[model samples]
Target: MTAYEYKVVPAPAKGERARGIKGTEARFSHSLERVMNDMAADGWEYQRAETLPSDERSGLASTVTVWRNVLVFRRGKAGDVAAYQPRKLDAPKPYVLTTPLAEAVHDQQTATGTSDPDQPLAHPMNTLVALPVASTAPPETPRLGETPEVARTARVAATDNGVEETQDLHQMSSILRDRAARLIAAEQPGRS
Candidate 1:
């Protein structure tokens, strides 16, 4: 929670004269502006103007209630903390898929040595496949401060079930990826 300090001061009684500024209302507004500006320069925020009643003796025994105009201002205290401000979430990245599904599946199958589906490829997930791409640019250079990617074949997810189960799941994913690619390819025109 934030703590604030408040200050109350009397409003200007009269406006200061200025060239080309004519009218009682305009002059009064100018006077108020002067007070507000002065307060602002001192790091005070103008809150509101109030008309407060004060009782004072008019004569020997007569008492009268008089209305007084005062300006209110407030500022954050030295030890005050700022209000909670939630951080904005970053925008989600879009998936950019360019290749026609059938073509991509064919390429992936060829690279993974799964082009002949009759026989299973040994260590399918262990082998890295480099698909044909149009870009002639030399392989990307690692950006500054970016950690180098760990070789996929050497990386394994440690799970409660032994490493063999993890390898089985990994191989299953590779099979699914290939199946999904082929299914998508079968939907494309001119693909068997």
Candidate 2:
């Protein structure tokens, strides 16, 4: 196992806002850089800055939050430099689940001769063939004073050639909506 140590420092003070001498402000602000370099030379690496807030009572029945910026640095545990070296970890094992309903479905498919014993069942609505069906019936002439763009066309079949299967687009969309809801629910953290 690896361990780390942290250091917290108050945010660097800014140079004087009033103009006086050229580069004086930059020179004054460089104090923070000097301190950081000095820490780095001692094996500390700069991490990040954070703003901490605390509520303080200002007057009776009122409270104010005071925010303070802090700079953070971290380093490995003392005398344990080897713990920081990168090492490979074994891959996680795959999860296997068995359910009664799944077995029932497999048995029913085998009994009905609808699926091969070695092959998995295929869902009919999972794959849809979308083809533009040419209209053989005579097209209806547009009514008087009606623009051609306003004329509605027949719906094309969403199936393979010469197949009489009908798939409900609304049902497919609802299934997708339900799956998305399940995924969103799984992503939320549980309360303690």
Candidate 3:
């Protein structure tokens, strides 16, 4: 509703040194703080800082871009009070997801009344809560006239399948060791 004026100035490159400041980072921050305070004392509200490019002549006919840091400040204009009404922003719409993940969340919410996780209706003394994994993808059905394609998977015989081929991780290592031993023996001509 009110018009505004802006002021921009070059920011301090280094921090101001003080008796109590120990590190360069601390000193630099102190310097920046001082600049902000000085501007605020003059009734200027602190705004955002920006990096802008400036073009400068490099040689006889060449130009180069130099990045410059600046601090921005703003205040209500003293003279202009009736012009430039800023556009009002509309509120964002509520997010409604209909995916399987959202459906799973809804299912879990109904099961334990975990919709409000802070005060779960079913669980009271739980230190850690693990959310149920939702079905990531829906199964694809074959078209009316088209047959479903099948993948060829090797069927291992019960006799040929060793203990090393078991689902256990430790058992898999035994198979690797056995294969390594067989390879070493084959490489040696003298050892049958």
Best by TM-score: 1
lDDT of each model, Cα atoms only? 0.74, 0.70, 0.75
**Better lDDT candidate (2, 3):** 3
Residue-level error in angstroms, candidate 3, position 174: 58
Ranking by TM-score: 1, 3, 2
Model 2: lowest-lDDT 10 consecutive positions: 151-160
TM-score of 3: 0.40
The residue ranges of model 2 lying beyond 4 angstroms of the native Cα positions read: 16-25, 57-62, 79-81, 84-192
Identify the leading candidate in terms of lDDT: 3
Cα error, residue 191 of model 2, in Å, equals: 99
Candidate 1 C-alpha lDDT tens digits along 75-152? 888665445456689999987555564465556678876777556655546435456679864335545655446322
Report the lDDT tens digits of candidate 3 across residue range 7-60. Answer: 999999988779999898999899899999999998799889999999999999
How many angstroms is residue 142 displaced in model 1 relative to the true structure, after the best TM-score fit?
Answer: 55
- Residues 85-162 of candidate 2 have per-residue lDDT tens digits of 788899999864356545655666766677675665565343233445899864576667766555443223322366
> Hey, what RMSD does candidate 3 come out at?
14.6
Clashing pairs in 1: none
The alpha-carbon lDDT assigned to residue 157 of candidate 3 equals: 37
TM of each candidate vs. truth? 0.45, 0.35, 0.40
